[model samples]
Target: MGIKSALSKPFASFVVKKINKWKYHAVEAQQKVFKTLISSAQDTAFGKDHHFSTIKNYEDFKKQVPVVDYEGLRKYIDRVVEGEENVLWKGKPLYFAKTSGTTSGVKYIPISKESMPEHIKAARNALLTYIHETGRADFVDGKMIFLQGSPEMDKKGGIYFGRLSGIVAHHVPGYLQKNRLPGYDTNCIEDWETKVDAIVEETIHEDMRLISGIPPWCQMYFDRLSAKAGGKKIKDIFQNFNLFVYGGVNYEPYRAKIEETIGRRVDSIETYPASEGFIAYQDSQTEKGLLLLADAGIFYEFIPTEEYFNESPTRLSLGEIELDKNYAIVLNTSAGLWGYSIGDTVKFISKNPYKILVTGRIKHYISAFGEHVIGEEVEYALLTVAKEEGLEVTEFTVAPQVNPEEGELPYHEWFVEFVKAPADMEEFRLKVDQQLQKKNIYYSDLIEGKVLQPLKISMLQPHAFINMMKAEGKLGGQNKVPRLTNDRDLADKLQKYLL
Candidate 1:
């Protein structure tokens, strides 16, 4: 056995034992988390307003606190931003994770000192769980390249602000730091392209064994690395590379391209992490979905996606969740976010282990012609069509073509950037349309009733999506092409760069 594997064996066994126990004790674990959260913040302003002192159990807590989105918590957050103490949590937040906003400027999510450890622990446990399950602890023996946001934070009103990845980069453990790349100076570079160049120069010949990042940016890194190494496959340059830890966006569409770039198969582990919290991770290799982090300092609630927009919606706890139902996730975290809606939709695929698949975003869907098509449906259709046609798609986005000039009926418009275009583009488009209709009955009915036109396909030139993101100043980590939009805004913008 390798030295890394030998050293990690005992810890890996411990992690495996803990995870095995967690599955059976998920309910008790979550209940304890909820109780601790309530007690921790009972003296805060939000807790008082929500009658936290009077709440005794889950039912009482639910009855007292209403489900709210970011906007609903804006007032409290604004106060916290002005350096108010104990406004949301027990004390001031150590930093604020700045994320893309909803139709506004930006969102500042509070990260408390008490909650930071939970975030760090969950992330560490994800890798540990993967190692335990896969028995591949030697992954830690070599360099693990993390393609992330700049570590350099900006201070505003006495609060540090930066991407969650950037913030986490600052806290990487000392032992792991010794095996990580690119260097600190390279990570601190502000521009995406320039930073990528620096990373290539710094780690071109290092003993890289693992890579973790958003799918699109990782693809960019692979392509650049290949180009720099005289067009050789990535595995040729980093022979020890054996694992890919990916998250932040769907990986299905990019899988073929990534595999082709690497020139060989590698074990992949997916995570469901957001700025609010590290929620889930791939625990078992045999499992098809992520194991919900019930024990991880975050209490989860599921609201039926359709009912989420209703005047009143039913919120179901982890025990009440049913398999295969789409739910808009609401979280009450140790970070002092009480009953807050994070806006992402997910569906439970397994119950015993409590595994879930992220379905879509709450605000991200196409409902323009009475046809409610979601991100999951679109992605499934696109991926299915690509696989059937032996095509490779780099990126894609969909929006409704509501204004079709004169008298034409409205249709779903797809802007796709293909690394390998299909031999029969028309056939590929028809298959995608058919697959989408199969996935969504409402879309099929609209097409059958002649209420909507056939799906329109527009192929984008190489680098178009990247250029669009760059122009909008969101070209790197965690920023992805909004898959399905309700309006023509994204489609119209991409049309300017159509091939």
Candidate 2:
């Protein structure tokens, strides 16, 4: 074994043990983080404005500071961009993670010096947790590749600003520097197509082991690798490539096709990360959920998904959250975001040693006909039936088809790209429709009442979604196709790609 591999096993054990202690004391850990954040930022300008010094509890916090999105905090963020000190957090932010939002356009989320390490630590622990549980530290010796944005940045008010993935690229640990592939110049390529080509060239002949990225982009990389080898599977190209690490989107929808490309299934890790914080990671190889990072420099509050927009939604702390119920997650972080709604929804799967599964995004859903179908439901429905049909799906999105040409009822249109299609297209559509009905009773009711017809599947050409993302200038680096849309905007644009 290499020096790094030989050394990581013991370090993994130590980190795992420390994580275990914090996991079990999760509620207490979160409470402590809450107190520390409130105490430390109490003297900042925002703290003074919100009476943070006098706030003693969650109740006081709820009453004093209202929930806000990026636009809601625009004034304070403007000050930060102008190099104002102590405007929100204790001092000037270390960096700004620039991201494009659906409704808010570009956003610059502050990452404090204190909060930056938490992002690094959480990502490191995900791998360490895998090593500790499965005793698989051998891959540490092989070249590792994380497909991410360019490390290039533009400074705003003396703060380095770029995509979150790009910003984190600057901090990859020194030990792994020798093992990480697709060098700085390759990563700095602007066009994603050119960049991914460079990534393939750099790592195609290396002893690559772990490949990490959002699923769709990983799929793109795999496609290039497969083509370069004249149809040889990815496993044949990189025998040591046994682990896939993904976040930002559910992997299940693309799993069948991705594994098909690999010619075998590999162990994978799921993570919950955002511009706001690194929230959780898959901690157990045997378990089903990502362990919540209660000690990760962020305090979490959850509002029931059904009541999220209520004038006073019930906000539950870590100790008060229940199992299997969807909630819109809110963050109060040391990065200067307070009572912030990150727009993602999640469901707790385990309590004491808290663990969660991301259910869907709060805004990304199809409720045009009062049949509110979420990203999770559609994914579950399609994948479940696709498994039965022995088919492989590439990517898909659902949007309401509100107006038919004439004398036709509106329906949910699923634009799907497939690697292997089932024999009977109509039958496959029926099964998927039935599965979705089973998962969502409201959708079932709509079908039965004739308010809407059954869902229709629009088969898309290969690379349809990729082409669409390219046209929208969101081809890579944490950008993903929205799984569900209430409007026809994306659906209409996607129609040209349908077969």
The candidate that achieves the highest TM-score relative to the unseen native structure: 2
lDDT of 2 by residue, 1-499 (tens): 8888778999999998898787899989988999999999988889999999898988888899888889988899989988999988988999999988877788999999999999999999999989988989888999999999888999999998998888898999998998998899999998999999889988899999999999999999999999998999999999999999999999999888899899999999999889999998898879899999999999999999989889888988999999998999999998999989999999999997798999889999999988889999999999999998788899999999888869989999999999888799999998999999999999999999998998899999989999999998889888888999999999999989988
Residue pairs in collision within model 2: none
For model 1, what is the C-alpha lDDT against the true structure?
0.88
**Model 1, residue 435: C-alpha shift (Å):** 1.1
Q: Candidate 1 — worst ten consecutive residues by lDDT sum?
A: 1-10
The residue ranges of model 1 lying beyond 4 angstroms of the native Cα positions read none
Return the top candidate by lDDT. Answer: 2
By TM-score, how accurate is candidate 1?
Answer: 0.97
Per-residue alpha-carbon lDDT of model 1 for 1-499, expressed as tens digits? 5676677767878977887787777888888888899998999999999888898988898898889988888899889888888888988899999987755468899998877887787778888887877778878888899999888898866989898999999889887888999988999898999988889888888989999999899989999999999999998999989999999788898899999999998889898888888898887677799889888788999999889888879989899988998999999987778889998999999888789998889899999877778999999999997887788999999999888878899888899999999888888888899999999999999999999988988999999999999988888877888899998778778878899
Q: What's the TM-score of each model vs. the native?
A: 0.97, 0.98
lDDT of each structure?
0.88, 0.91
Clashing pairs in 1: none
